[model samples]
Target: LLLDIVRLKGSHSAEHIRNTTEQILDHLSINDKVYKIITDNGSSMIKAYKFGLSVSDQNFEDEEANDEDSMDVDEQIGY
Candidate 1:
């Protein structure tokens, strides 16, 4: 996923966030599957909730468990 942020002096941050979120949701809802998502470290985006989808924290866990089933089972053990 690509996040395009336009610098507009007068626009509200919430408006931009809302528009972007809606656009992303619309596109993703129609597509086959949403594998992963990327967003900047902004206040609005940081609070994004994971609804049982695969989310990458950009840190490699291990080499052996790359698949979802292994990752899910291993994540609990790690915690």
Candidate 2:
């Protein structure tokens, strides 16, 4: 689900976007729930996920791969 959208009036440099995205993730308390953040093929988005969000595109950065699958199944059944 689309939970939030942050709009800025100033320039959106990579560093700025990274910081903003991190803060938003922290504020929402959904950091662990996030796996992959689908975004446009923009450098800022890629950098935000890599450097700022610190998440890999292919993996969820978690030790247990099954944890995410379990979470997905749980969410599907309204657990």
- Highest TM-score: give the candidate number: 2
The lDDT for every candidate, in the order shown, is 0.52, 0.70
Could you tell me every candidate's TM-score relative to the true structure? 0.33, 0.55
Q: After superposition, how far is residue 72 of candidate 2 from its true place, in Å?
A: 17
Which candidate leads in lDDT?
Answer: 2
User: What's the lDDT for residue 37 in model 1?
Assistant: 55
lDDT of 1 by residue, 1-79 (tens): 3544455456546555555555665665732244455667776555543342343443334323477667798898994
What TM-score would you give candidate 2 relative to the actual structure?
0.55
Count of backbone clashes, every candidate in sequence:
0, 0
Give candidate 1's whole-model lDDT.
0.52
Task: Report the lDDT tens digits of candidate 2 across residue range 1-79.
Answer: 7767889557777777767766777899977566656778788777766743455554554536678888999999999
Once fitted onto the true fold, the runs of candidate 2 whose alpha carbons sit more than 4 angstroms away are: 55-79
Can you give the lDDT of residue 51 in candidate 2?
40
Model 2 alpha-carbon miss at residue 50, Å = 3.4
